[model samples]
Target: MSFEHEKQVCNLFHNSMEIIGRRWTGAILVSLMDGPKRFNEFHNMIPEISSRLLTERLKEIEDYGLVTRTVLSDRPIQVIYALTEKGAELQPILQLIGNWAARWDSKPNIEENTTEKVLNI
Candidate 1:
């Protein structure tokens, strides 16, 4: 490939990782991959996430054009979160990551509630 094209590709990959690497963003995208989910449903799905962080992640994804939030005209103004077309396209990538995780999952060396650290072998 040409130098300019290579640089462009690298930049796009860098930007994509920077955006997706944020806390809960990747999880939220993966959760919404199947279809729309309500706010409470997301909370239940990802029990570890705090409300503030959840709200922040949702807004961030929405701002990134990957998520579409629909407000239902119901008694309580229900909100549903769904992936946009671009977001849906990320399914393959997520699956690949999941596949890689499965490879290491069987030999997980980290204990629960422990901060991650690399073992220099």
Candidate 2:
């Protein structure tokens, strides 16, 4: 491959990692795969994350065009966060990562989680 091609590939890879490699970012993305969620719903999905941090991460992805924040008009305005097409594209990537980790990651207690329980079959 040409040097220019290699350089572009490397740049793309690092850029992708910089966004997705942030702590809790991948988990947050994974949590959104099923459908839209509210702020509290995200917190429930990732209980370890602080509300402030979750807000920050959501804003970051939204800026990246990966997530969309929609405010609904109601008695009390409700805000919903959903993955954009770009964000939805991460689902398969996450699944591949999970499959790889399941094979090689050394966390034996992983099976204690609910997903592992269901995946055990």
Candidate 3:
């Protein structure tokens, strides 16, 4: 492949990593797995998230092609979000990550810090 094409691929890979690495991306994916839901439904489900941030993350997820957005024609129009097939593919990946995290759960951060200090000296 040409150098320019390789550089473009690397940039795309890094951009994707940055998107999923955000604080709430995982939770947002989990939240959408049940079914398509309206904005208010998501807001209530993920109470810890601020409205602005949730909207931002949802837009990012949409841009990534993992979710679909639909608008309903009704007396009061509604906007709903649903995970596309690609988004659903992350469930097993998330489960594996959860299992990996279980091993480190409740471990002391100070212990790791001290170990790092000792290793450096």
TM for every model, in the order presented, reads 0.82, 0.88, 0.73
Error of 1 at 19 (Å): 1.5
**Ranking according to lDDT, highest score first:** 2, 1, 3
lDDT of 1 at 74: 98
Could you tally the backbone clashes for each prediction?
Answer: 0, 0, 0
Q: How much is the lDDT of residue 9 in candidate 3? A: 100
lDDT of each: 0.79, 0.83, 0.77
Off by over 4 Å in 1: 105-121
In terms of TM-score, the best-performing candidate is: 2
Per-residue lDDT of 119 in model 2: 26
Q: Regarding lDDT, does 2 or 3 come out ahead?
A: 2
TM-score of 3: 0.73
Worst 10 residues of 1 by lDDT: 112-121
Tens digits of per-residue lDDT, candidate 2, 13-110, equal 99988998899888788888888998998878789999899989999999988899999998589999999999999877877776767777787776
User: Considering TM-score, where higher is better, how would the candidates rank from best to worst?
Assistant: 2, 1, 3
